[model samples]
Target chain A: MECSVARTLDVIGERWSLLIVRDAFYGVRRFDDFRADLGIARNVLADRLGSLVARGVLERRQYEARPPRYEYVLTPKGRELLPVLLTMMRWGDRWEADDDAAPVTLTHTTCEHETTPVVTCAHCAQELSWGELRTDPIRVRIPAR
Target chain B: MECSVARTLDVIGERWSLLIVRDAFYGVRRFDDFRADLGIARNVLADRLGSLVARGVLERRQYEARPPRYEYVLTPKGRELLPVLLTMMRWGDRWEADDDAAPVTLTHTTCEHETTPVVTCAHCAQELSWGELRTDPIRVRIPAR
Candidate 1:
């Protein structure tokens, strides 16, 4: 459970949490929009949003003073979760979507080319596929008695 | 709700689900191994494993005939989830772990280098950092009513 993946999941592992973050990436900022877009129950949406804000994945910014209405936006920490969402999207596109179409297509705005994103080694910059990568046994630093 | 990411999450979004899959990736195949490694309660573990098997993410193989002992292994579909887990691990390393250490070290076995995996555009092979990507409004193909 000390693993980083587990830790990251600790903050955003709830059922509706990552979807809310994904909606934020799509520029859906308001509570009503998130609720409508996700088709999530109201209380569930509220809870997920509150937990996301509490976890620093999203922050509330007031846009109305009369009723003190607010919208949520991704924090710096949340925005950095792009890869996590993207990879999931890519996996979904590959495994879950119809063969002819993906529900969402990712566009690299700078290159202006639409494409699937991939994982590559930071050092060699080679695209890593299954069977190309391996893990060494993790060495626990606990003191031996 | 019909989005691929949502569909993918439908398969693996439950609490401890991905961790169970993570344990599978680490070669923890036997039930006791998964239970000991995850510290998950037996009932919860059994439920998750059954769901994983039913959903095609994992499959059970009978290893002993006398008492019908079984072990789980990732299927091709499950194995394709590599990027999703890698990105999560990378995010944890950067955000959750201390500057000096990460709990797990990923190695590019083919390249034989110790490194972090990053996301890149499949088309341009350019490293995609934050803010370099953008999304177009998805064009729904539904026939106009």
Candidate 2:
């Protein structure tokens, strides 16, 4: 549980939380739109939204003053999650999809082409495959409580 | 829900499922090791393991026959999830970790250097940032039921 991955899961590990982030990436901002797009119960959606905002992944912004209406927008931290979602989508498209085209394609605006994302080493810039990577245990300098 | 991300979530969406996969990457193969490391309910661990196997993420192998002992190993499909897990861990290390060093470091075996993974477009090989990509809806031909 002390692992970074475990800590990450502690924040946005639940199905509904990740799905909410996915919906936000799709430009879903309104409560009704999120509920309709996800078919999630109102209470569940509200709770997840609250947690995401509290966790600093989503920020609540007021879009209307008279009705006191607001929308949830992805924070920088939440926006950084695109790689995680995109990688999962790539895996699903490769392994889980039926014998049909992917339901959505990601276009790299910089390159003007549809793209599949691959993980690369930041230092060497070599594309990583499963066999090319290994984990080394590092001593975590735990602070005195 | 028809999107690949949704489908991927349907398979490994649960927190425990992904955690179990994470542990497998860290070389926790035995059921007891997983139970101890995760501190998860026995029934929940068993259920998630069963689902992962059924979903082709993990393969069960009999390591001992006398008492019918088995271990779960990641299949090729499961190994491909390294990017997803690595990306999440990187996010957590960057944003969620306390004032401590990362608990583990990934090394690229080919280059013999510590690695931070970045998502890169397979076509152009450019590292993707949040604003550099956009999703476009693609028609998936639904199979006749």
Candidate 3:
């Protein structure tokens, strides 16, 4: 797809993929840990992990040599997905959570405050909401069939 | 399921659901329009639209009366998902896009500059990155078996 959202979804759009990435952020590196934490089927987890690695989101490193064990770690590209996941968590906490309190809270290490992630304009640094932004179609290049 | 990100994924984690929402941000309203844009299966699109409407993200409003035609519009809750979508787009552009230029750019209407959305701590307004944030587990309530 030409749209960036579609392209991103092509890589990590599925619930399992994002959930696995979430688990990775939680520092669940071993395959068994991901399967245990997510309760995902072994085949599905394997497939997602393989795809993520192939897509350069996760790096597979041999952690043990005797039994030939591997661990999945987020690459730089995968680490950059933190904002996407953080924003989703914030949205879910606001709209989907059962309780008033967030199940988990993010602490900004630099400022030492319980923080809510807000999307801000990189140029003016203004916190942006839906109303404060407009889409500027820079160029729409129709893909050649 | 306890994680808000997982909860949010329970709602819109599917690729098609997010694609439809992305199209909504692009001002797509009609069923035909969504179908035309995404080339998604009609039944799947119908199912997704129905679920989104049921979830209060998209509202179906009567736009034509000749044969009871309706258009899907983003509700306040749906509009709140813009940041989620924007962050994903930003991530995709950074990693997935083959070209340097983004297919579309968001302009901060307040600042009138092409903007990149950055996640920031709401309290101190400092730009947040993965290393600068730490996840604190508040509480985990076990579900009754």
Best DockQ goes to which candidate? 3
| Cα-based TM-score, every candidate | 0.88, 0.91, 0.92
Compose the digit string of candidate 3's lDDT tens values, residues A1-145: 7888889999999979988888787777888888878899999999999999999999999988998999999999999999889899988988898875647888899989989999899999888877777777632222223
Q: Go through the candidates in order and give each one's C-alpha lDDT.
A: 0.82, 0.85, 0.86
Candidate 2 per-residue lDDT over residues B1-145, each given as its tens digit: 6778888888887789988898787677889888877889999899999999999999999999999999999999999898888899899888888885645788899999999999999889988876788778632222223
Clashing pairs in 2: none
Residue pairs in clash, model 1: none
iRMSD, per candidate, in listed order: 4.4, 5.2, 3.9
Per-residue lDDT of A1-145 in model 1, one digit per residue for the tens? Answer: 5788888889888788998888888778888888877789999898889988997889999999999999999999999898888888888877778766547677887888987888899888898775767666653222233
| Model 1 chain A lDDT-worst window of ten | A136-145
In model 3, residue pairs whose N, Cα or C atoms come closer than 3 Å (at least 3 residues apart or on different chains), thus clashing, are none
| Model 2, residue A69: C-alpha shift (Å) | 0.7
Report the C-alpha displacement of residue A114, candidate 1, in angstroms: 2.4
Pairwise TM-score winner, candidates 2 and 3: 3
* Candidate 2 structure quality by residue, lDDT tens digits, A59-121: 999999998999999999999998899899899898898776646788899999999999999
